[model samples]
Target: MTGGPRTEPIDARAVLGRCRDAVAPALRAAVARLDPASREQATYHLGWTELDGRPGAGGGKAVRPALALISAAAAGAPIAAGLPGAVAVELVHNFSLLHDDLMDGDTERRHRRTVWAQWGAAAAILTGDALLALAHEVLLEAGSPDAAEAARLLAATVRELIRGQAEDVAFEQRDDVTVSECLAMAAGKTGSLLATSAAVGSILAGGPAGLTAALHGYGAELGMAFQLVDDLLGIWGDPAVTGKPVLSDLRSRKMSLPVTYAVHHGGAAGRELARWLAAPGPAGEVTDEPQLRRIAALVEDGGGRDWAAAEARRRMALAEKALAGAELPDRPRAELVALGRYLVDREF
Candidate 1:
């Protein structure tokens, strides 16, 4: 007998919502311990409150934490066992975001002014530091048997994240970015934390080492796919959906994967694009909107967009393969598959 269609759609929204609900209390409690100014900035950055501190509806998709929780459940542990890891991963993720926004000079996020833009750079930096410290504090206080190891893993991941950010900043000033270098930077910047997020749940639950390794691999692949999609969005996504200016990455001349691929692979078109990018201003900055648009079109004509999209699908497949290798319970395994699908398949 022939098998039917093997994959089914998952309710990503519901899964993320449930994970957010489960982890929100602990996250809030951690933030509540911050001093008043830091607390307000942190809470606003997390979408827990408006600029004035009233409750608001802005929040992220909760994908990283959901991966932690779902991975824990897949390991045959209670969902509560994953809570500390989930919250810790979310905190670390946001810590990076706050710093990244400042470093990238981004003024907006989630359709609102960024923490740095709204509360000033010092407040944003301090609040980010508070979040990072609090992640460790909360993990250590969880009293899990593996709490120490979890804390160590998160600390190492943070160091790797900083390295990635540093490389990204350095790449902006250079014109000789190889695709391999770009991928390595993406793995460091985006993949390391996600790998930790996936493995932490299993580690905290004291799951088998093999299972934890498998989940880490899965999460890394998923993270690569996620970043590739982000690169696509930076070029072509709707401002309303992405909550940023149109073609913001191009305008800033960010060396996103698609742009990198185009610059390397587009032949004559690539050369033309490079000339425009090299047309720096008095301060060595490229900020002309008309030129930015031309570079975007050149990237498209050179097949950067198609290559990045294809690469995203390839990474998603790798993630699915890694998930298949893990010995998860059927329900949670299916959910993980669904989550992987949702991550790469999103428009925003």
Candidate 2:
């Protein structure tokens, strides 16, 4: 239970269970309308159907949609009003996953074939594009003011996302990356969309302006915390639980927090890591592993993981502070806090 909720945490599990239950059906119905042929293929890849087209596994954790609904209730908005917005966020989230798999040359996600692996890169790209379009279309049903705000958020978030991706790719070729720069890149790539989700959810819920502002602040902090945790998991988490190869981030020369720290704290190991990451190579391929593992060890020795965990905890505190300022009702607020805690503690 190390990466799960504590049983003595005052029914946090029960609260999150209720929120998850409420969100899942709406997410399913939203996905049910894709053209049968394409839908079947996507579903197959998602492990919702067998390779032979029989019923199969459950889909992803559905966290983004759940956040939207949970935030809506916390803001005193009708949960129904947030459904379209939730669906929009989910569509956008999945679209990012599809494209990310291709960019990282990953073969699998959620223990199933990635869109690129199952359908080829061109098909995956097209499918992701289609999802992006559908995400926008879904936002149109979010009501006038909500739709307009969500659309604005979507546009700005995409810009930041692309900028972050560019920075991430650029980090591979440069030895000058600082910890601050890496955090900025992380914010643009990972935090922007999450911040938008909370902000849009509040808008849809008809929350007071102050409450909506507080929710956006909460999401930004939580998003930062989430990515920091992800960086830690990428390097040190059990492969079976994380569903990815160990030290995969180092192998790919990605500029995550650990790598940034190692770069700053120059030494034999840091130099070795810098040397490997700066190796001139084709984009989007894993480089040397022996050297990468050595660097990962150095990172651990240098307290990079500890530093990152502390930072994540700090951000979590900030998020909670923002939530408190939002002044949500007790039941819904408790659920939201539980959900946030669960996100921070997730193993996969």
Candidate 3:
């Protein structure tokens, strides 16, 4: 938040870039296999191309794929052994993104128009579905001895993901949502896939069960930290940095972790916030800048902001703890710890 980027023991950006470079070729090839329309949409969504088919300079952190590759390395396998799983994980991540952008009615991402905004809801849905299907295809064709089990794991994770998304949507309409329920939803939506990402590669490489399970636990806790930071950014992150409008989560009256905690425990401020949330008429997007600022302030005053940050730190510690007791290769194990720190501390 202060310096441009944090670089100490490890340059996380450098590490992430390397992972992206390793994963990009196969990811591109898989995207190329989509039908023309879905291909265009997928490429655009992935920041590989512009809306009009030209090259673009936008892309995500590639954290999930990175986790998969590192998980393979941590298991003492060649990183190449993780390629198919990494590609599958990345595809699934984007599938969720396309659908999330559509469902959230977000008009932009990565400083560009969202798929649903540029294309259409139907296009977004179908393209997302194509990606989901392709993820399974990639895994099954991987030829790894553990491919079937990995695919099954992915399928189960997807179910948890949808369950989380459904809970997220349901929370917006109800004012009585609990903090524990919010944590559970965050786990389902974010933790499930991340756990898969961290351990699927180990599964692919036939790693021992103990290490694989440890990596999975690491990912799950890291996911919680990741989502908490994201929620904070949704309310307080610079639009220029986050590629989103200010207070985007509060705008939609989203019952994010911070807001839910504030409403559940903020005393007078929480009561005031609850009234605003439950006001008459559908809780639509709030665009007034001053009002948005006040709501963000109320969330802070109600302890949502501090609570979220503390919880993130707590989760990060737990994630790192999962690695400490495991018999993991030094390099990837350390990298995994670096990656988890970046997730909670990242500015974008």
Per residue, candidate 2 scores C-alpha lDDT tens digits across 28-118 of 6656767664566556654568776778876666666666776688677777767777777777877777788898788877677777887
lDDT scores for all predictions?
0.86, 0.74, 0.90
Predicted structure 1: lDDT: 0.86
* Top candidate when judged by lDDT against the true structure: 3
lDDT of 1 by residue, 257-345 (tens): 98888889999988887776676745633567777678888999878999999999999888878877768777677777788788788
lDDT score, candidate 2, position 346: 68
Which residues of candidate 2, in runs, are more than 4 Å off?
1-17, 266-269, 279-292, 346-348
Q: How much is the lDDT of residue 92 in candidate 3?
A: 95
Which should have the higher lDDT, number 1 or number 2? 1
Output the worst ten-in-a-row residue range by lDDT, candidate 3: 1-10
Tens-digit lDDT track of model 3 for 47-156: 98886668989688999999999999989999988999999999999999999989978788777899999889999999999999999999999999899999999999
Model 2, residue 97: C-alpha shift (Å): 0.9
After superposition, candidate 3 runs with Cα above 4 Å error: 1-8, 281-283
| Candidate 1 local Cα displacement, residue 74, angstroms | 1.6
Task: Return the lDDT, model 3, position 45.
Answer: 88
N/CA/C clash count, model 1: 0
Residue clash pairs of candidate 2? none
